[model samples]
Target: MNRSLVRHWIALLLLPLLAACGTTPSSQHYLLTAPEAPLPQGMTPSIGVGPITVPEYLNRDSLVKRIDSNSLAISSTERWAEPLEDGILRVVALNLAGLLQTENVRLYPWHPKRAPDYGVKLRLVEMDSNAERVVLVAEWFVYRVADDSTVARRLSKQSRPLPATTQNGNEVAAAYSELLYALSQEVAASIAEAQGNPAAVSAPST
Candidate 1:
């Protein structure tokens, strides 16, 4: 081969190697935690939940990082908290449906054949995570199906901090689980009160 041709081939071969020099692995995953316990008892009068309403800001790109406001700084691609919210809603529905009995509890997709006596609507006002703690705020309303009147309304808030020596997915999942559990209990308590079941009006914090 000619000398110049040999040198040109060597430079072409090295170009690809140089292009591959700077690369980094992504360090994030989409994870969510399940609820901790069963739903509250005595949720009679049959209730149906409407489509959950999330804050507009939560629907934007980078949902997880945007919701995890507690973090000092989060990568643009991190997606931890948004999935956590979805998990929480699913678990809450499952637990409540089981405890209240499927016949008496209805989730989304209200059926004409299985019309419930009351409808439940939830609005997530705030869900943010920080290094020290996570904060959640929500409002719930129970409407009487017959009259279409709001029979009960309540707002709940919770803040939980990370345990010492830990900052992993498991810890985050557990924290989210606890927060969901709390919200479910509050909703159940309000339902119980509306039903005039004083005994069911109080739910265990645990």
Candidate 2:
């Protein structure tokens, strides 16, 4: 056979092998979810939670875990179904809605005319899991928008122990959800303090 013919025949024979090699394992996607519960039946000021920021490194769709204090690991086969910041905002809103017993919950990017009585700001300082535990740390603030005042400020950090036998992202996602719930509770306490004032302010929902 000519050189070109020989090369063509070889390429045809390798096609199936290349196709098989191209098949990759399906990735596992995970979501952060809070406990299922009812919204508070009572009427309250509208609440806005937003501008929750994450580190540039943690902004990717992949799930991240700590290797050591200075090292980290990104899972190629495990990923987030949505942006991590959005997930955190959503879970925090759900948690606050249940804890505050008010449906006046909102996420960020509030309507121009809709100003929330209070705003929740959060910065994700650290979020990582290792073989033993998952840790979440944030610097948060509660603001009174009407007066442009900061009503509360806190540095919140939470750690949850993972089961020794835990082996997947679901467990880690669950742990993150729990940590978010706990953090929302802390913000709720601050809101409760702000609610004592006679101002009529509502929160923003995204």
Candidate 3:
């Protein structure tokens, strides 16, 4: 074989190995935290948050993504369905526990020694994100565990405008913070009302 041809074949064989050496798998995880809400007065209810039910549409491979006029694309390097759902539940529990003047608020997957006085169950019906706004619709029910009766049930909707020029972590966090804040407040007020606090009846209006 000609020396030039032999050199060319050697270069071709090394190219793939060189490319593989430069490629490193990403080890990043996408997570979102819920913001705190105002605490209700004179209450120490031990609340149990049931599994959060998300809609089929929102249960996608991509937890974070971008939708433009032309196409929809994922933002994260990896897509994890279980972690995102677990993260959402954790955030919700954290927000609620912080907002309420409760002795303790525990996330489910726990077998309560005794049934909690009140339980919070949520169904996330809609969670649509767009360039202009993020709209969320959730149904919540406050149940009395002793009697297995619903003390109160409410359907809450929140819509927050997204920043037009921002597409980074801070912007996304801010948007989620606002939405979770609204949701936590609504849940807190409902629990207060269930505890017979008349003041809480109108707390969620804002």
Candidate 4:
């Protein structure tokens, strides 16, 4: 065959392969979201949520799962609708409001005069999942601006099983959101304890 004809044939053969390679799956976005629990009978919100942090690996738009003890699997097609940190902040704040039966919840940077009576700061250590379960470990503290001191502090770890009937990435993501809601319950309990007796707040180790 002539060289020009041979080159044309090669190009034609590669066309379909290139097209197939370029056919990427559509991305599926998921949110770590939770519904507000109903406000309690007479309580109102009086807390602010702020300064939540997550690990660098969990900071991405993609969801990650621990596939093995030492390995993780990152989902390409399943993505976060917002940064994971922001989602955590929102869920925790909303959950607290509902748990405490108040509408006084606010995010950071509220005017000092309008600031809630207490502030919540969260540091997320291990918020991850596998096919079987989702895990969350967080360090949280409640601060009282009037006294310029922390009134409550505790480390909380929680897990929720991925339902056997639930499907892959989507289900795992929902599990994570549920875990946050669970963790918020612990935080709220601690806050209440400290309120009745500030001395109950956990102190730093020696």
Clashes of each: 2, 14, 0, 4
Best candidate (score: lDDT):
2
In candidate 1, residue 17 scores what lDDT? 83
- Cα-based lDDT at residue 113, candidate 1: 77
lDDT of 4 by residue, 39-145 (tens): 44444337888889998888899888897888888888888999887888888887777677666788886788886778899998898887678888999888875
- Candidate 1 lDDT over 1-206, as tens digits, reads 99999999999999888877645445455445444334445546587876577776655434332334344344454555454345556766655554344437677678777778877778889766655666778888878877788877888898788777755545655676678667776766666677787454333335
Q: After superposing candidate 1, which stretches have Cα over 4 Å from the reference?
A: 1-23, 26-31, 36-45, 60-86, 98-103, 201-206
Q: Write the per-residue lDDT of candidate 2 for residues 49-154, one digit (tens) a residue.
A: 9988999889999999998988989999999999999999999888878777778887888886888888899999999899999999999999987776998898
Highest TM-score, which number? 2
TM-score of each: 0.70, 0.87, 0.74, 0.82
Q: CA lDDT, every prediction?
A: 0.64, 0.86, 0.68, 0.78
Model 3 residue 186 CA deviation (Å) reads 1.0
**1 or 3, greater by lDDT:** 3
Model 4 TM-score on a 0 to 1 scale: 0.82
Candidate 2 residue spans exceeding 4 A from truth: 2-23, 197-206
- Superposition-based RMSD of candidate 4 using all C-alpha atoms, in angstroms: 6.3
Worst 10 residues of 3 by lDDT: 197-206
> Which window of ten consecutive residues has the lowest lDDT sum in model 4?
197-206
Clashes of 2: 14
Please state the error at residue 159 of candidate 3 in Å. 1.5
Query: Alpha-carbon error at 158 in model 2, in Å?
Result: 0.1
Give the clashing residue pairs of candidate 1, or none: 70-129, 70-130
